[model samples]
Target: MADFKLTYATMFNPPEELHAGFDKAVEKLKKNMGQEYTMLIDGKEVKADEKFDDHSPVNTDWVLAKMQKGNSKHAQDALTAARKAFPMWSHTPWQKRVELLRKAASLIEERIFDLGAAMALEVGKNRMESLGDVQETADLIYYSCYQMEKNDGYIVEMGKDPLVGYDARNVSVLRPYGVWLVVSPFNFPFALTGGPAGAALVAGNTLVIKPATDTAWIVRLLVDCFRDAGIPDGVVNFVTGPGSTLGQALVDSSEVDGVTFTGSFDVGMKMFQDFGKRNYVRPIILELGGKNPVVVSKNADLERATIGIIRSAFGLQGQKCSAASRVLVEDSVYDDLVGRLKETASKLVIGDPTDRNTYNGPVVNKSSYNDFKDFCEEINQGGGKFLVGGNVKTGGMFDKGYYCESTFVVDLPFSHRLWKHEMFLPITTIGRVKNMDEAMSIANDVNYGLTAGFYGSPEETEWFFDKIEAGVTYANRPQGATTGAWPGFQPFGGWKGSGSSGKNAGGHYYLPLYMHEQIRTLVK
Candidate 1:
């Protein structure tokens, strides 16, 4: 197939003859395999007659192009290719695999802006957030490579234990989970998808990837980057379709040995139960949604506190799993901070995320917009008053877009479902607490414990550090600050529906876990 490049711009550009018309968006996405999108199986391009239309959320009228959609055939092909390549890939020299992963990392770094822009257009993330996501994704690649380079194939010994001073033998090894299925989400598509993909690939695992429809454009584009980095054919496959269909196709496949998924909790539980019920399952690592909390203290610096909350709570339009949807503030500073928060939030211009001036963007689609709307109605029904923005109204065609107004509800009852729920929208609920005891009570009340953000004096910060039931807790930080994975490290999943495994990603120490060990006794 001849090569062709596609460009997705951040700004609203008028379409050209070469571009497809988008009533809501410009031609921000185009997939070209021999001049148009075609699926790849073992490096061979195959066209599908049916197409999937991907939209850009920047404008409601712009209609992104319709590209060939994958079918059961694609899922089967990905599994087939992975099965065929598994033996060879798993047997590749550790050093060679490490080198390949490093190369993939470098290639991703070079295309950071290119991929980030695609996200801003197709995925509805602001430039800063998009840039952060792309970088975090690429960083995972490098992190996996570093892990691979340091892989200790295994361990064996004939020595001491409490009961046995003399032992016959001991051993350890990392065995690949044969064929891995990575199904990513609409939010943080790159980072969530990239973490598992990079780790599974560099660990000598052949894999299939199915990203959310809202953002598969970037997923496919990144696959190209992997190819440019010399990733072997069939070692990585990209597919997208109805989740239930595609998910069942891979999970039920006899050849698939593992699954990595990031999305909603209801779906996650279904996948988990199915894997168990089928009894034909492999390992499944999931990153489910959470009602993550952020706390503000009486002694905290309101300046730092406000910046943190705004970005964390509202960044990504509150679509982040780690987005600070719950807030517990000390009564001493509650009135003043909420007032100041109102001031800061009011200053934010909610509009197209692709624009340099855009601080907010439309949600992924109309459904997410309604989710925000319905929840706000519930809050208002429960006697909460809106301090800042509360209604959804768009002006002009651009205004007609799926823009959810920034919303904050005060005076919500602690018993309301909204307080404990994970609201992945622009709406946030801020509560006032009397002291440290009340603050801890508020923070620990939720079932979701993925992450926490706290602003206070060192001692006050320790209150959360000690009592907050979460995987991540940041003190004296902004809302959106310290929320993602950096290069050369790992970010783990949290308790109570966040994930099953302890190591979420970049546990480079576990390369041996995905490997096989052989032991032979030589008789003298």
Candidate 2:
């Protein structure tokens, strides 16, 4: 019945309605209810003095009551809890743990809508987009179950080495670190969190999720969903705070055996540095900032390419770590491509996110919009012509929520800093490259190498594929038109500045982060 503002400055409070079916079920199962939002430490709730508001970015719709703003004290609490729980969790029978993960996945499937609503309100995504996030998260949950169960070492087998008569060993067994600190970003909060937590839980690691302060309600909802699946307390916990304090706690905590982060490069690198301060470096998997580039080949399809480029770069208001900020087109097709891009970009309705028809919603807040706007100005000052959109205003009828023109610009070099740094908003820079080599040269020039796409013939695709340097590369496509980050395969993390290790999210390789592998030998 009540509405709230969605921005960074607001405070999040848990309200009564949060318990509709979500809370009642927890109580029916005799789950503890109405505990002060606290650090989940050693499988228990410990209170915190600080709290922040979880808001709706779409409008000034103030949703949830105060979200717990975590501090070093809270981080210590969760780390302690994870430490105590880790020994048992790490050694927990992997098969049994796998079943628990399946339960978690099922719980998500049943309560998708409840979580979806929280996502829609908190993060400013529309109904369907929120659902997509939830579904992506749930798919990851289900995959985590199989990932652990079907892992090489989960089932025993025999093998022989060339020098040894009979050498037999399972590939590797998964073990939980005593503690893991998870820092999740605002975009795709559910899917992002679910990927790691599902694997960690299956591998018997306890998780302390520091979800984005903006979407704490979704985090709260996710915690309850896991609880519904009979996950024990402290196995999965919540902490809402600025990344600085909490992230430092994890990096410095002796008990925190590992950490997984999905956010900007600067923050991820800071954590990596902190992790290095100790002798035994905790595992740190960072899915960081991306300056993804889309290369439109001379022979590519413009109409489809336009739609794909818009969706790829601007979807989710261009707030994703993998958002395509740079658009490199072959000069032969550059004019037509830029014109079509501007035409389609102009049609995107940037306004109140609640309206389903609104394609591009506001950025997370004014700071993001201002940064994007300033970036556009800087580009314009550099002599780039604004083909369409790109004008932004603050402090008017719409003051708090952030929104940018579905901006399109041309004449900027592909190597411009505007394309180099990640701008968590919907702005595209269309650059013209003279030939295939020029396109490849410009595309691979950025420091951050997350994902890139090439639209051309099979030979040109092969040529670019061989030359372009990136973690995730696509061919004959406009960039982000496909689903699940990759076709059939979910979005993989990138390398260079893009990702810490460049491991794909949904593939079988994700388990190695939480679980350390060792091969033992018996000789006679």
TM-score of each: 0.88, 0.87
Worst 10-residue lDDT window for candidate 1 reads 1-10
For each candidate in the order shown, give its overall lDDT on alpha carbons.
Answer: 0.73, 0.69
TM-score of 1: 0.88
lDDT of 2: 0.69
Candidate 1, which segments miss by more than 4 Å at Cα?
Answer: 1-36, 153-170, 479-482, 507-524
Q: Summarize candidate 1's per-residue lDDT along 305-342 as a digit string, tens digits.
A: 88788877787888988888888888989989899889
| lDDT of residue 316 for candidate 2 | 78
> Candidate 2 at 522: error in angstroms?
3.7
Question: Among these predicted structures, which one has the highest TM-score?
Answer: 1
What global local distance difference test value does model 1 have?
A: 0.73
Q: What is the number of residue pairs that collide in model 1?
A: 22
